[model samples]
Target chain A: MKKIIIASTSAMYGGKYLEYLQPVLQEHFKDCSSLVFIPYARPGGITHEAYTAKVAETFTAIGINVKGLHEFDNPAQAVLDAEALFTGGGNTFLLVNELYNTGVMQALEKAVHAGTPYLGSSAGSNICGLTMQTTNDMPIIYPPSFKTLGVVPFNINPHYLDPVEGSTHMGETRETRIREFHVFHRQPVVGLREGSWLEVKGSAIVLGGDRHARIFRQGQEPEEVAPGADLSGLK
Target chain B: MKKIIIASTSAMYGGKYLEYLQPVLQEHFKDCSSLVFIPYARPGGITHEAYTAKVAETFTAIGINVKGLHEFDNPAQAVLDAEALFTGGGNTFLLVNELYNTGVMQALEKAVHAGTPYLGSSAGSNICGLTMQTTNDMPIIYPPSFKTLGVVPFNINPHYLDPVEGSTHMGETRETRIREFHVFHRQPVVGLREGSWLEVKGSAIVLGGDRHARIFRQGQEPEEVAPGADLSGLK
Candidate 1:
C-alpha cells in the first residue's frame, strides 16, 4: 500500500513555502510522529542543515518532528528506518547525483514501494517518475543516469508552464519541448502545473489542487485533466 | 584566425531565417564558394536532407553552395575538406548525441579552430562555448558528454529571455537558472538575446546586433555588454 504526494512545487504564487499543502500534509502524515527529510536537492545551493531546518520549521507547526537524512550516518538506512519521508525541491541533477552516489536511490524506492508515507515537491516529486527527461531545470551537473525511481508509471514535468501568447522568444515552449521529448522517448509525460499535485494510494492516483494537468501520450493529442480526475489508468 | 558567428537564433522576431545576418555572412564567407553544413540539430525534428536544403536555400541567395555533412561518406573528412561550415539549431542533446556517435565532434572542432569560417545558431551557438550547461533547450536525449567546442572562452545561453514583469510562474527565470549554473561551474555565461550575436574574429569577440548581452561571471555581479562591445578582454 504505497502512499505518496507528488507536488509540482514547494511554494505557489505569493504563498509561503508548503503553506497551501499543510492541511493535506497534516492529514496525510497523521500516522507519523517524525519524518526523515532528504535535503540533497539543496535549492539555491543552501546547506543541508539550513534546508532541513527550513523544512523542520514547517513540519513542527503540524506537530510532526523532522530530521534530515544527512544527519544520519547511513543515508540508506535512514530511508529504510524512516516512519515517513519527505524530499524537498532543488536541482534535479544534483538530487539524482547524490541519490546515486550515496546508493540511497534503491533504498528510498524500496521503502516507498513497501508502504512508507512519502511526500515530494518539485525535484523531489520528479524522482518518482520513470525518468528525469521531462524536467525543466538546467543541467548544472550530470547524474550517472537520467533513470529515477519508477514509483509512477510515467515521467512528470513539474512546474509545467503554458506558452505565452505573442512571445518574441525563439526558444522552444514548454509544450514544444515535451513534443521533442516524444521524438526520442515513448514514455507518457504528465505536465503538472504549479499548485497541482498527484495523490497516490496503492494503485489509485488522483489529481489534486486547484488547476488542471496536461497529459501527453506518444502519438496522441495532449489532453487536459481536471482536478480530482483519476489518473490510475495511465499506469 | 578563427572566424565565427555565434548567433542566438537563426531568425529574429519577424524576419526570415538568416535574413538579418545575410550581409554580415556574405562578408564573413567572402572567399568560400561552398560550405559544409551540420544538420545534426534538426530543428523541429526535420530530416537531414530537408534541413540541409533549407540552409542551401538561404546560402544560394548569397551565391554560395551548401552541402550537408550527412550526405558525405565521411562526415569528419567533409568537415576537414570544407571551405566553410554551418551548424543549425534544434535540440542540443540531439545534436551532441549525433556529434559524438558519428565521431564528428572532434573533427568539426578541429576544423573550426584551424581558421575555418564557421556559423552557429541557437543550439549550434551553444556548442561554441565551454559546455552546453547554459543552453535553454530541454534535454530530449542524453549526450555522451556536455563538453563542447570551447571555440569561445565561456558558455552561452541562446534565446536568452528576461523575467516577465508580472508573471505568476514559479519556474526559475533565465537569470536565476544561470546563477544556479554558476554554483557548480566557474565558466562565465553570456545571455545572448534573440537578436544579439557574438562576432568572433581571431581573438576579438564582439557583441553584435541591437540588444545588449548579459554576462554572468561566477561570484561577480552580472554586467550588460552593449552591442559592438569588444569582449576580447573576457578571453
Candidate 2:
C-alpha cells in the first residue's frame, strides 16, 4: 500500500517555509519517528545540507527527525530503509538529473510503493506524475530522461496559475503550456494550485486543501474539481 | 557579415501579428525578395501551414514572400539556399527537436553565419543564444542537446517579465529561474522584455526598442542596459 502526499508548494505567499503543510505532514508521518529527506532540488540553488536543515527545522516541531539523503554514503539504500520520506522542491530538471546521477530515482519510487509514507512538494510533487514534461521549471540541466515515478496516473503542474484576466504578457500561460504538452502527450494533467494537494492511501487518491484543482485531459475541456474529490479516475 | 534580428515576441499585447516590427523588418531584409519561415515552434499547437500562413500574411504587407521550411522536401538544403530566414515563436523544445529531427539546425546556423538575413521571435530567438537551457517553454519533447547556434555569446530569456509586486503565487519568478540557471552555467543571459530585440550586424550587437534589457552574468549582480546599448562585450 502506498501512503503519499503530493503538494503544490511547500510555502504560501507571506508564509514561512513549509508553514502551510506542517499540520498535514504531522498526520501523514505520524507513524514514523524519522524520515530521509531528498534535498537535491535545492530551491534558489541552496546547498543540499542547508536545504535539508531548513526542512529539519520544520519537522522538528512535528516530532519527526530529518536526515538528508546526501548525508548517507549509499543514498539508494538509505531511501529503502527510511521510515518515511520527503522530497523538497526547486528545479525539476536539476532534481531529475541528480536523482539519475545518484541512482536513487528508482529506489525512492520503490520505497513509496512499498508503503513508505512519502511527501513531495512542488518540483518534488512533479516527479510523482507520469512525466516531467509539464514542469514549469527552466531546463537548468539536462536529465538522462524525462520519465518520472508515475506514482500518480497523471502529470502534475505544481504552483499552477490561471491566466491573468487583463495581463499583456505575451508568454504562454500555465494552461497554454499544458495544452501544448497534450500536442505531444496524451496524459491528463492536474493543475495543482498553491494550498492544494493529492492524498493517496493504498489505491485511493483524493484531493486535499480548500482550493479547486483544474483538471486537463486531452480533447476535453478543462474542468475544476473541489477539494476532497476523488482523483483515482484521472487516467 | 552576419545580420540577425532576435525579438522577444512576434506579437505584443492586443496588437496585430508582427505589427510593431514591420518598419524595422522592412529595412532588415530590404535586399531579399523572399524568406523561408521555420514554423516548427507552432505556438498554441497550430499546424505548420497555419502558422506559416499567419506569418506570410504579415510579411506580405512588407513586400516579401514567405514560405515555411516544412514545405520544402529537404529542410537543410532550403535553409542553405534561403534568401532570408524567420523562425516564429512557439515551444522551444518542439522547435529544437524538429530542427534536429530534420537535420537543419546546423545548416541554419551556417546560413546565419554566412550573412543570410535572419529573424527570430521568442523560441526562435532563444536558439540564437549559446544554449536553450534558459528557455521558458515546457519540455513537450526531448531534444538531443540543449546546445544552440551560439550566434550570440550569451543565452536569451525571451518574453522576460518582472515579478508582480503583490502577487501571491509561490512559483519561482522569471528572475529567480534565470538566477538558478547561472548556478550551473557561466554564460551571460539577456532577459529580453516584450517589444525589445537584439539587432546583430557583423560583430556589433545592439539592444533595440524602448525597453531596457536585464543582463545576468555569473557571480555578479544583474544590470539593466538601455536600448541601443552595445551587448557585444557580454562574453
Candidate 3:
C-alpha cells in the first residue's frame, strides 16, 4: 500500500520550519530511521548542502536521520532504497526540471507506489498531481515536459490564497487562474490552503488539517471541501 | 527604431480597461488610425472576439479603430502589416503558446523592430522583455519555449508587488522569486509596479508613469528606479 502526505506548505505563518507538521510527520515516518531529502528546488537559491542541513535539523527532533538525494551517486537507487522520502517546497519549475533531469521522477514514483513513506510540500506536492500546469510559481526554468509523478489523480494549487476584499491589484486571483486552467485541461484541481494536506494510503485519500480546501472542476462552480473529507474520488 | 509602451497592467485598481494609459496611448498611436490587437492571452478565459471587443471600446474613445489578430486569415501577416499593435493582459503561457503556434512571435518582433507603435500590458508587457520567466501569472499552459520578444534587454515582472508588512503568508515574495530566477539566468529584471510602464524609443528605454520600479541584477541588491529614469543601460 502506498503512503503519502502531500502538504500545501512546509511552514505556517510565524511558525518554525516544518513546525506545524511535526506531529504528523512523526507518525508518518515512525517506522523509518532515516529518509532521503530531495532539495533540488533550492528555495531562495540556497545551496543543496545548506538546504539538506536544514531538513536534517528538522528530522533530528523526530528521531529520523536525513540524507540529501544529491549526495548519492545514483539518485534513483537512493530513492528506491530509502526507507522514507521527503521533497521540500521551492519553485515548481526548478523542482520538475531537476526531477526529470536527474532521472529520479520515475524511481520516486515507483518507490512511493511500492509503499515507501513519502512526504511532499508546496512545489514537491504540486508534482504529485497530473501536471504542473496549475502551479503558482514563476517559470524560472523550462522543463522537458509539464507531466509529473501523477501519484494523485487531480492537480494541486499549493499555498492557495483567497481573493482579497476591496484590493486594487489587477493580477488574476487564485480562483480565476484555476478556472482559466480548466479551459485548457479537464483535470480537477484542489486549492490546497496553507497548513492543510492530503493523506493518501493505498487507494484512500483524505484531506488533512484544520482548514477547508476549494475544489475546482471543469466547467463548474468551485466547491469548498472541509478537512478530513475523502478526496480520493476527485477524478 | 522601436516605439513601445510596456505597462504593468492595462487597467488600474477601480479603473476601466486601459484607462490608466489612455493619454500615453493616445500619443503613442496618434499617427495611426487602425491598430491590430493580439488577444491571445485572453484574460479570464474570454474569447478572442470578446477580449478584442473590450479593447476596441477603449481604443475607440481615443479615435483609433481596433481589429483582433484572430480575425485575419494569416495572423503573422496581419502583425507585419499592422499600423499599430496592442497585446492585452492575461495568461503569459497561453499568450506565448499562441504567439509561437500561429507563427506570430517572430512576425510581431520584426514589426516592433521596424518601429510599429506597440503597446503591451501585464503578460503583454512581460513578453516585451527578454523572456516571460518573470511573470506572476499561473502556469495554466505550457509554451514551447520561454524565449520571448527581446525588444527590451531585461525581463519585466509585471504587476510587481512589495512584501506586505507583518503578513504571515508563507508563499515566497516577489523579490524572492526574482532572486531565485537570477540563480539560473543573468538577465536583469525590472519589477514594473502597477500604473508604471517602460517607454522604449529607438535605443532609449525610460521608466514612465507615477511610481518607482524595482530593478534586480544578479549578485547585487535591488535598486529602486524612479519614473522617467533611463533604463536603456540595463543589461
Among all candidates shown, the one with the greatest lDDT: 2
Q: B1-235, model 3: which lDDT tens digit per residue?
A: 8999999998888888888788898899999999999999998899999999999999999899999999999999999999999999999999999999999999999999999999999999999989999999888887999999999988999999999788778999999999999999999999999999999999999999989999999999999999999998999
Residue-level lDDT tens digits of model 1 in A92-145: 888999999999999999999999999999999999999988888888998889
Candidate 2: Cα lDDT at B37: 98
- TM-score per candidate, chains pooled: 0.98, 0.99, 0.99
Candidate 3 Cα errors over 4 Å, as ranges:
none
Chain A TM-score, candidate 2? 0.99
State the lDDT of candidate 2 residue by residue for A1-235, as single tens digits.
9999999999998999888877888889989999899999988989999999998999888898999999999999999999999999999999999999988999988999999999999999999998999999999999999999999989999999999988999999999999999988999999999999999999899999999999999988999999999999889
lDDT of candidate 3 over A110-170, digit per residue (tens) = 9999999999999999999999988888999999999999999999999999997777888
Candidate 2 wrong stretches, greater than 4 Å: none
Instruction: Residues B1-235, candidate 2: write the lDDT tens digits.
Output: 9999999999999999989988899999999999999999999899999999999999998899999999999999999999999999999999999999999999999999999999999999999999999999999999999999999999999999999989999999999999999999999999999999999999999999999999999989999999999998888
Docking class of 2: high
Q: Candidate 2 chain B: minimum summed lDDT over ten consecutive residues — where?
A: B54-63
Error of 1 at A71 (Å): 1.4
| Residue pairs of candidate 2 with colliding backbone atoms | none
On a 0 to 1 TM-score scale, where does candidate 1 land against the true structure? Answer: 0.98
Q: In terms of TM-score, how similar is model 2 to the real structure?
A: 0.99
Model 3 scores a TM of 0.99
